[model samples]
Target: IVLDRSGSMAFAHDEVAKNGSPAAAPPGWKMGHAVPKDARWLDTVAAVNGFLDIMDDSSHDERVSLSTYSDKSKADVKLTSDYTEIRAAMNTHSRKFKGGATNIGSGILAGGKTLGDKELARSWASRVLIVMSDGIHNTGTEPVPAAQQVANEQIMIFTVTFSDEANIQEMEKVAVSGGGQHFHAKDSQQLAEAFRKIAKSLPTLITF
Candidate 1:
């Protein structure tokens, strides 16, 4: 999965209820509450973890990798078949960083390279790329061209737009160009459900 670590993700959304709180309110609130800044990052992590938890273990042949992007991009973890190692790497590598630009193009390219590096050992029937972002393509090489490059390499590019601030039309075009799905998630619940949808669709692709 490719996560956008851009600064705009700090924007708040509505909160959900738990514990003895009223079904509509979060804590000391009315019918609704916005997500606190302190809680957004953890909510993202939990959403990712929830998706990982539901993935079917039967597909042992497949390998998964992760990448995050902001002002620049880097590979958090390379493609690996070992779930334990991936989980550990995710815990260690997925840090909260506040950067100005969103280098989503570079992020996708990095993910493609990571997957390509493992292509010799693991032949994937379908290569999947999941990108989650909350803002427009303000910096880096234009996203569409980069996305096209990845598409030419036969990688499916799934995208999740987390905020209205993002150019959803362009993101959706990227997904269509790469033969992947596009999701719009404005809050924690929508984000979690989006991840679940991605997990459920994983089986449709045959991993070599």
Candidate 2:
């Protein structure tokens, strides 16, 4: 899964006190970036963990990798069948990287590389890039070209707009360009449901 960890993603419902804005944050925290106090970020992480848990329960023989991006892309979890390891890699976001900008194109490139790893490409029957984002891009290269490049290599990409404020049209275009589907989640519950549905490749966006 490719997740966005940009500044825009770190917004609290009840603002706390971050860089003049009321938002809770770690000690000595600076402005221009998000801290752990973001409700939306918490929701995204919870939904992702839930997704991993569901995958573990299914016990499907699948190798999954994780990529997170904000001004740059980091492949935290290389392709592995161990869901627990993936979860651990995800949890390290407590010490998140500098994310004043959203480099979605970098995320796509990194994920595509992970899937296209020669050793993996030979064994894996399918490759899919699932990118979840809650904000529009502010920095980094335009996302479409990189997305197109990844798509050309046959890595289908599913773009998830994590909130109503998300750029649905851009994500939809990304999905179309990458030969995958687009999904929108208005709340935490819907986000969880979307993840579950994606796991099963179901047609509907809702689970219940």
Candidate 3:
């Protein structure tokens, strides 16, 4: 899976302050006032943890990987089946750094490389890339070409757009180019539901 860790995510409507203290909603903001006191980042972390908790482990031969994109992209882990380690890494670093531009193209390319590695390619029945972002492309190469490259390699790419600033048109293009699906989430609840749907549909390419 791929996550967008840009600065915008810091204000993802659900993220609370970096410190443990409650986040204050803007004055007169009735809607956001009802949001949880914690930072949206923490909420995202919890959502990811929840999704991981219920993931099907019956397929012993399956492998999964994670990558995040920001000013600089990094593959936290290569394709592996070590859910314990993956879960630990997610809990530890999911809310680490919060700055820079969104280098989505590089992230997708890197994810493709990790997925295309000889061992994973030969063993898994399917290879999938789930990209969650809340903003438009501001860094790295254009997202469409990178998405096309992934598609050419026969890797499925799923996208979740979580902010009004997100370029819906571009995201849609990328999804179509990659032969994947595009999803939009306006709030934390919607985002959580979108993730749930993606998790439940993990074993197949078709959306639920």
TM-score of 1: 0.78
Predicted structure 3: lDDT:
0.69
True-structure RMSD for candidate 2: 4.1
lDDT of 2 at 49: 84
lDDT of each: 0.68, 0.75, 0.69
lDDT ranking, best first: 2, 3, 1
Query: Runs in model 2 with CA error above 4 Å?
Result: 13-34, 121-124, 202-208
Q: Can you write out model 2's per-residue Cα lDDT over 1-208, one digit (the tens) per residue? A: 9998776566653343133432556666654444556556677888888877776766456678998898888998888887787777766664553545778888889988998877655553577888898878667767788889998887788889876667789889888888888889887888888887787773232221
Ranking by TM-score: 2, 3, 1
Clash pairs, model 3 backbone: 14-40, 15-39, 15-40, 15-41, 16-38, 16-39, 16-40
Query: lDDT tens digits, residues 1-208, model 1?
Result: 7877655444344433122332332456421233233343445666777776775355546667878777788787787665566566544433423434678888888877776775433663578888877777778877788889988887888888875566789889888877888998877888899988887877774231
lDDT of 3 by residue, 1-208 (tens): 7777665565656443232323453454332123323445445666665666656444445567878778777887787776676676655554344445788888888788888888656643576787777778888878889989988877888888875767878888888887788888777777777778877776666431
- What are the TM-scores, per candidate, against the unseen true structure? 0.78, 0.84, 0.80
